[model samples]
Target chain A: AQSVAQPEDQVNVAEGNPLTVKCTYSVSGNPYLFWYVQYPNRGLQFLLKYITGDNLVKGSYGFEAEFNKSQTSFHLKKPSALVSDSALYFCAVRDTDRGSTLGRLYFGRGTQLTVWP
Target chain B: DTAVSQTPKYLVTQMGNDKSIKCEQNLGHDTMYWYKQDSKKFLKIMFSYNNKELIINETVPNRFSPKSPDKAHLNLHINSLELGDSAVYFCASSQDRGQGANVLTFGAGSRLTVL
Candidate 1:
């Protein structure tokens, strides 16, 4: 079965420092990867996606992810972290097999990012 | 206006009660989905509909029924809700199926607490 794994249960980073939340996926066909962030008691918001082309994908709220096909990893990254950037991050993937409806998303358990001042 | 919205953001009901959560998306997308987030914050896809046709149905309980009146609306109704049904439910919509890279627009999830 296709799935995503976020190894880090929690990542603590100091504000203004670089931050990285790791994600690895297992899929059968070409993978369409995505990153989403959720603040406390809020809905998951779209951050970025890797469909095709471009190994580095930039997204909203100054977030980006690097897609590595050989390693089957799509790690979320940020140059400088902010105190407000603390939230739960999820990595999801969908296989582009024939007749795939493109609705169901296999999501990771989520990584909690804590950017402290 | 919220692009995707789910009614009754917080639902507290007794076990065995039948309840329904209504969802509407104004993004003009062709596909809609329901995702369940467990107490551990693990997200899983429960059901999906494209243009009012059921396309994806995961290993969900038969008590959970989804109705898509149109492309813009997909409602979920649970019969004899069990205590294990307590979780956060999210409604999402995306463009047409087979769009290679479908970006989903999600609503503020409805928190269901079955006591």
Candidate 2:
């Protein structure tokens, strides 16, 4: 079974400062990791994904995530945060091994990010 | 234009009443999914249809049934609405489920409140 864990429930950061949201995953085979952001009363929007490439992956809205295989983590980061960046973030994972369950994303609980000015 | 859209943005009804939520995707994708977001904002997949065929059906209640009339449309109908069924339902789609980089595009979501 594949699963994702977002250790933090809420993360508060000041605007124009750096921000980090942690995410970890467990998969049977190769992992396809993804990050999504959702504002209030809206659906989730895709941020970035890591399939099989460089460890560092850049995404929308000046956000980036580092895929650390050894640590089994993919933490989202931003050099500068904005007040509009406050939203609910989710980390998801999918197993590459195709047998019974393929292309199904197992999402974490979610992390609420609040960037204050 | 919206890539994925769902009807009935907000729904409020009694516990015994039944309701249906319609979803459609215009991205020409082959896969469509239904997800439920609870009060705490935990999103979970309920059903997925690929090319008008049932692909993934999670451990959902029998009262909830998903119908895919075609490749571009997937609608969810609840037989007997309960208070526990109150949540925000989302419709999502992807190009295909065979690849590794299949990212899901979601709709705006429909909020259901059962009294």
Candidate 3:
């Protein structure tokens, strides 16, 4: 079985300040990881993914995440926060051992990030 | 044109009734999936179809049936809808189950409210 955890239920950060949303995973072999953002009454929008290569993956809207193998963590980070960045974020993982699959993702409960102006 | 689309973005129905959510993808993807997001914002996979063939069916109720008429279209039909079924249904698609990447393009979601 594969699973992900976003330990923080909610993160509060003031505008123009750096922000981080934490995520961790439990799985065997290599894992495919992703981050998605969802606004109220809207579907999730893809952010970034870590398949392999560089430990730090950059995504849209000036967002990036550092993949730490030792920590089993992929934390989303932004240099500066904006009020519009307030939303629910989810971390998901896919197990490659399953098959040549667009593997079924195991999602975390999601973390709500608030950027206060 | 939308890459992945679903009809009736909002569906309000009564318990014991049947309803269908239609999903279509134009990205030439060979794999499609249906996911349920509960009120608490928990996501779970209900079904997956690869090239119109059932691939993964989770521990979902038998009342929930998925129909894939073709590779580009996959529809979800719920029988005797229950209050527990009131949640957001998301339609997603990927290039293929074997393309190595599991990145799914999702629809806006169909909000199902069962009374």
In order, the first chain's TM-score in every candidate is 0.96, 0.96, 0.97
Q: Runs in model 3 with CA error above 4 Å? A: B97-100
Score residue A54 of candidate 3 by CA lDDT.
Answer: 99
Write candidate 3's Cα lDDT for A79-113 as tens digits: 99999999999999987786666568888999999
Model 2 deviation from native, Cα RMSD in Å: 1.7
My TM-score estimates for the predictions, one after another, are 0.96, 0.96, 0.97
Residue-wise C-alpha lDDT for candidate 2, range B1-107, written one tens digit per residue: 89999999999999988899999999898889999999999999999998899988999998999999999999999988999999999999988645523789999
Give the clashing residue pairs of candidate 1, or none: none
Please write out the lDDT profile of model 2 over residues A18-108, one tens digit for every residue: 9999999999888889999999999999999998889999999999999999999999999999999999999999766784443688899
lDDT of 3 at A99: 62
DockQ, candidate 1, comes to: 0.69
| Candidate 1, residue B28: lDDT | 88
Off by over 4 Å in 1: A99-103, B97-101
lDDT of each: 0.92, 0.93, 0.92
Worst 10 residues of 1 chain B by lDDT: B96-105
Q: A104, model 2: CA deviation in Å?
A: 1.0
Query: CA shift at A30, candidate 1, in angstroms?
Result: 1.2
Name the docking class for model 2: medium
Q: For each candidate, report its DockQ versus the true two-chain complex.
A: 0.69, 0.60, 0.69
Give the per-residue lDDT digits (tens) of candidate 1, residues B1-115.
Answer: 9999999899999999999999999988989999999999999999999889998999999999999989999999999999999999999989864542378888999999999
